[model samples]
Target: MTITLHHLRYSRSTRIIWLLEELDIGYSIVEHHRDETTNRSQDDLFAIHPLGKAPAVDVDGRVMMESGAIIEYLIETHGAGKLGVAPGEAERSAYLEWMQFTEGTLAMPVLLTMLGPRFGGLDKLPLLQGFVGGEVTKLLDYVDAHLEGREFLLESGFTGADINMEYLLELINLTGMLDQRPNAKSYLERLMARDAYKRAIEIGGPLVKLPG
Candidate 1:
């Protein structure tokens, strides 16, 4: 299969890059740059997928979007028994939960919390800020507690779930949100240290820059 990854620098697509390196697959990348003024995706991505999102993979000719789906597909098709928790496996439920949690539950508030200032500082939207803040706290606390004694999301080490969850954790970490969650902080540290992740950073650029 000819695999082509449409990658956006500093976006969640880096997760796919890291996973591809981990899987040791031969694939090519079609790099896309964000619009400087808007910081939104450029027209190059629009030609690949209708939504013009990064992390879209062209497998042999069919385009696939959605990071979670792409991650799951890559694992099932190309993973070679690596980075996946099989059906009926002991950690299957936890694996699926954490894998989906990044986008399904954590994305809205996390994105709003990070990008809310672009619209207006959270101060300007007090109620929305309050709701988003509450959700962020609740979700972070849950993940932190889950990571207390675990090295990865599941008892089995280093699955796709980690790839799914760690990208969001990296964003939060950059904003200093992981400090209070020691377990999560430690887990993030461990994940960032992986060679595949380092390669992803080198290939795709850092996951957003630190505030000046």
Candidate 2:
């Protein structure tokens, strides 16, 4: 299958690149840069999808958007049952839960945390920050607790669900939240150390590491 990935530096799209590497498939990358002043995606992305988002993948000329959807599709279509658990598998339910959890439950508050300070100074955004902080703490605490005594999200091993999760965890880490969550911290470090992840960094550029 032909895959063309529209990648944005330091964005969630990096997860897609990482998974493609883990799958060991041939794909091309169309790199996009954030605006210097606004730090938002460029207009070039609109040509790829209506949302004009990064990680808009063109597979066999059919465009796919949303990082989670793209990750799952690639796993099902090209992963050869490597990073994903097929139907009737032991951990399939858990796999699906974590996959949806990244975007469905976790992304909003993480995004608000990052974008809050930008709209207003930290001092002025106290109420907003307070609520967002609580939500982030609660969610990550659950993740960290789940990760205790486990290497990856699943009992089996590293899977596409972990790749789906890495982007948000990295952003949360930049917020200084991971410092108190030992299991999550170790988990992120382990993910970053993977050879496939290292190669993805080389291709997509490292995650920005700057707080939103």
Candidate 3:
């Protein structure tokens, strides 16, 4: 049976679609439209995910949710010796390290800062916003420094770790914060150069809104 990805357009789900393309796997895409009136995902889509979140998948006979978890599962199952390091390889530890760092250390702060305005406008909550911004900047700088002499996040080639990092880096760029680091800028360019990423964009490009 084909894998069925229930995804929302222009969201983090793009990473999953991109990873699948990178793996050269065939999967069916199920588009879920958000309801502007209810400000929720369509009812039918809600049934598949209680939180009504996107990037969920029906892999074979099993159901899964969350962008990170889905990518991990795909890499472990489909990537194996291809897009990731093998089990006993010395780089495997570092591979997992960057993966966790991307989500836990890097993304957490960036997301908190983004939510600052919604919770309480950054101006109204200066202290909280400052803390979050400080953390985000720290993580960005860490990544930039780490990439100074490196071509990829792990191993000698692009791996699932890079895929995960790409999503976070794109978000950083969107927030106009990536230009502060030259290494980050160069890394983003290399990621954009991948043929799989290019094809993934073509497949999912309609959903991507280019910045004016």
Candidate 4:
């Protein structure tokens, strides 16, 4: 059965779209348009998942929420070991750590940094924003150094870990944080150079928007 991906434009669901393209598996996309004003997903999304979030994938008969969880499930079910590290294998801990880390650790400052201006109230305190910016730089530095001599996150080559972590890097690039970190910027370039990434972007529609 072809899986159904509920994709929200300008959202992190692009990760799942890219993963499906990389897996070269058959699936269908259900595009959900975001509110042009607020840039939020439609309330109709709640019919699929309570959170009304993007990337609520329909796997056969199951509805999966969360981009990372959907990526994990797809890789495990269809990737046939090409894109995921098994639980007991070497680098499994790192794999799992990074899989969770993208959303758990890295996303906070990345989103906070972007949303600070939108959310306002923090604009007056450049010091506070500067502090958050420092944390963002720290996170990018760690990722850049780690990716210095490697093409993929794991020694095993590209895995779901890359799929999970890459969207955050895309966000970082959008914020222009990548300019200072050549390695991280190059990492985005490398990942985007893939035919799958390009196809996914085409399939999901362009993510680029007018800068805020």
Q: Return the top candidate by TM-score.
A: 1
For residues 1-212, write the lDDT of model 2, one tens digit per residue: 79999999988889989999999999999998888888887789877788878889999999988887898899999988799989999999999999999999999998888777678754587887788889988999999999999999999999999998998888878879899999999999999999999999999888774537
Give the Cα error of residue 167 in candidate 1, in Å: 1.4
lDDT of 3: 0.78
Ranking by TM-score: 1, 2, 4, 3
Q: Could you estimate the TM-score for every candidate?
A: 0.97, 0.94, 0.88, 0.93
Off by over 4 Å in 3: 37-40, 115-120, 206-212
Error of 2 at 211 (Å): 9.2
Query: Which one wins by TM-score: 3 or 4?
Result: 4
Candidate-wise lDDT, in order? 0.90, 0.90, 0.78, 0.84
lDDT ranking from best candidate downward: 1, 2, 4, 3
TM-score of 3: 0.88
Off by over 4 Å in 1: none
Listed per model in order, the count of residue pairs whose N, CA or C atoms clash below 3 Å is 0, 0, 0, 0
Runs of candidate 4 exceeding 4 Å displacement: none
- lDDT at position 4, candidate 2: 94
